[model samples]
Target chain A: MRSRSCIDERAARKAQPALRKVGRGASGRGHGNAVPLPGPASGRRDQRRGMPPMMRWETRDEICELVLADEPCNEIGTHMLEALERFVAEARKLPARALVIRSEVRSGFSAGADLRELYAGILTRPREEHVPALRSFLDRIHAVMDALDTLPMTTIGAVHGVCFGGGFELALTCDLLVADRTARFGFPELRLGLIPGFGGIPRLRREVGNAVVRDLLLTGRTINAKKAATLGFVSQVVAPGEATDVARRMAAQAARFDRDAAVTAKAFLKPLPREELAREKEHFVRLFQNPCVTEALRRFVESKDVRPYLP
Target chain B: MSDTVTRLMALAARRFKADAAKLRAEADFFETLGIDSVQALELLSELELEFDVEIPDYELQGVKTFTALAERIDKRR
Candidate 1:
């Protein structure tokens, strides 16, 4: 079985220093450089100055709300991953008692991994550099997921529209998932001949039953919010366009609890499935090495089918 | 046309704001509704909620018409 030790030390080492920098370093590429968004109570105009285009956050009344606004369904790519890393680091330093992650994009919360970008990387980079590069990317994203998973405060994902693949994994990191009637959850990685690379399988299995996990992963079918709620993963299913409001209320309630008691309970109930997550990453890297993944990604990116997002 | 087809067409028109009279059973829903894949998923969700049936996305693969979609829902019902 491939393990963390099997990963290239050189590539892993290269990612460590960058991860350490956390928020804006001397290079001014961190949260410090992000545009200051108006807090929920501020009623101030949004200031988009210098904000990373992928994400932005505001804190008020000891609550932090981060908005994912990347265009075209908020596909997670290098830009989004970097933005998330910055958010994760900044979240640790905040005085917030609860965090709410929501999306402002019209289409959905997020469509998933940016297959076009992945395909582009594959075509532009040499085959020898592929696995190492992929592993590094996975490592960085996993770190963000781990950090979010273990944050001292309560976290809620206000989901709507498409939450598939990497996006589904990201939502799974939340302490609670609040999906609107319009929200849909899916794992379509199998269609591309790859597993969910962003620590999805382990987190999903932890939240829902093994049967539900197998159904979504193996069939590669998307499920609507009502169906997801019935399966017991989604904590609440609000009316359409009301997920964020419901999430904000949940955050408020969570913030009212004793911090230490809440943190302890969270730690005990939702310990990170570290071993499984590591194995999942290794499995993803192994599967990604196959040529079929590349070809499948190519077909996805190049396809003109109006229903390409469907099975 | 079957009642299922008629109701399906009506639902699509209401969800997508299309002209119910203009919606033909055989017409491609993608073209008739002027929607892409994402909107198609939204339509799928509406269908599930309306019909109270779970339609795996794969079941709708290559299905692009109102009558065909109704048949899928009918089988589930």
Candidate 2:
């Protein structure tokens, strides 16, 4: 079998040029999306040799930027999960004052969970082990999300294109979301016969009302960045390819404030919905046990239709 | 064709760099323009921006031609 990193590298190379073009007309600086580089601050090729395939982070001007650039779209599979875990670990040790999570993939921020990988796992493993495996993955992801959510520094999600399911959930982990006009946000898990297992529900409820949450979850319909802004979930709606730039500025502003005071204000303003999050994981695990989920994922993974992403 | 369909066809043609005169209101856009999923999404974004309306992706399910898409946009308007 081929290694995961190799596949991601191939896709990264294939997508690099088009990804670069997304920033061309934005600011004339042409740095619309920051490509992931190896090492903390030094741009050295040697340090890149063993870097993770899914993402990479670097700190500059006291702001740590994590760029998600894997594949056709950054699907949250084992590779992404592990990469995120590594990010949290590195982030905690960094002296950075702010964090910005963005994507360099031209297709979007992310399409969501790696449905193909999930389906393959179901096929290879025993049925009895499925729930346990899912539970383990959820537990690990939730831990990472919780850490990011409660991090003292202000975190911003600079999102564009498709931010659905787990991807949207990942964005919600940030303190604020800055979306490009082309961005579309949704929770399409209902189409897969499951709920978003990555704490999307509770996190979203923290940002918006229940009616908005219900519409997204029940309809599985995507909303444009403009609609998302009106719904009060996205903090800023920017021109195409400018989300990262806007987020970086926001991070800069955040850095100017007293770090301890900012941290305290964030803690006071945004409390984690611990109970709802725990209940959500249980509901997700229970829903994942249905055989229909496997079939739904299989169809999604194997689909050749142009609108497969459309729920 | 209705005016909505005509305008929708023209918008799609311009965005995709196709000949506006050669495009038809009733043509299957995905087939006519040779677009994949990402381009289809770009078109969706362009339409939402063009029409100033939110036509949910589910509403466009099975909608292939500019005429059908125009109807959905019209309804939302």
Candidate 3:
């Protein structure tokens, strides 16, 4: 079987020079999207290592940064998920004072799951044939989030571009959310006839209250960074290119504390609340088995038109 | 390490999924226990909460063994 890591590495190496170019994607001009490494961009060698080098992990002083600096849409996929798992494991051991997660993908933080993978495979296949795979995938993703949510150190999500579906849920896991003006957050799973499968609903409800959560999930609507801030979740909303820079500074400041105190404080603020993560998977798979879901997702994959889920 | 420490470490090793028998006073994490950094930190945090003593990260930086950890906690207590 081909390892997901190898598949991701291949994709990373295939990027054009423009994709790996450092400092500010085309959208941010020179001030945007800092690549983790400084060099001539040896993505080729990185690919040889059989892992996506785009999603980078870095530690400076006592601070660690996990960057979602991917090309095109930086869509979340199994490979990216695997990379995050490895990064979190390492970060836990490092006992870093803070972890900053940010996306520099110009198109969006992520376009949710890799629509191609979802559509071409599960959506197009017989529901019974693919349900097991989808269930396994969601379970692994939840495990990743579980590890992330329980990390003993502080976490900041520096969000930019489109944070949709699972990607949006991933950002919400952070202790603090710092979004760029260009950032837009939403859950588009309804369009594909599925719910946010990664414990997003419970977390969203906790952050934004019941009514707003209903509006977002039911309508599959998106809110810009300013509106998100108004909702009382975003810690800071900055100009187009400043989210990462601001978030890093926030992390640096957060890192000044004694580690144990920070962990205790976080635990006090957000106790391990009862959640229905397992149920989310059960519901998601049940929904995915519906003919409506399969047809909707198939149509999405084929045409990319997104009108079905809208209210 | 004191016998009390040996007992404490036995519990800590269980939490870390490590063998308590290999957890020697002088084994020091990297040299003897071979506990990964993450496991070591896990043990530290578990111990801190267990003892209700805050172990500073600086103190943990050079700590290498079960004995060292016990000594640090003793000083704090």
Clashes of each: 1, 0, 3
Q: Could you give candidate 1's per-residue lDDT for residues A165-196 as a string of tens digits? A: 88888899999999988898898888878788
Per-prediction DockQ scores? Answer: 0.41, 0.40, 0.01
DockQ winner among the candidates? 1
Give me the displacement of residue A220 in model 1, in angstroms.
0.3
- Model 1 chain A scores worst on lDDT over the 10 consecutive residues at A30-39
For model 1, what is the alpha-carbon lDDT of residue A273?
97
lDDT of 2: 0.75
Give lDDT: candidate 2, residue A255: 91
- Candidate 2 residue spans exceeding 4 A from truth: A1-52
Fnat, model by model in order, equals 0.56, 0.42, 0.00
Q: For model 3, report DockQ.
A: 0.01
User: Could you give the TM-score of chain B for each candidate, in order?
Assistant: 0.96, 0.94, 0.76
DockQ of 2: 0.40
Q: Residue B66 in candidate 2 has what lDDT?
A: 83
lDDT per residue (tens digit) for residues A100-131 in model 3: 88876655566566554454455244545576
Writing each residue's lDDT as its tens digit, candidate 2 over A1-311 gives 11111123422222222111122111111101111111122223242244335676777777888889765667676556766777787677777889999999887888777665566567766777777778788888899989999888999999998787888888898999999988988887888787888899999999999999999889887888988889888999998899999999999999999999999999999999999999999998888788887687656545556556442
lDDT of each: 0.76, 0.75, 0.63
lDDT of model number 1:
0.76
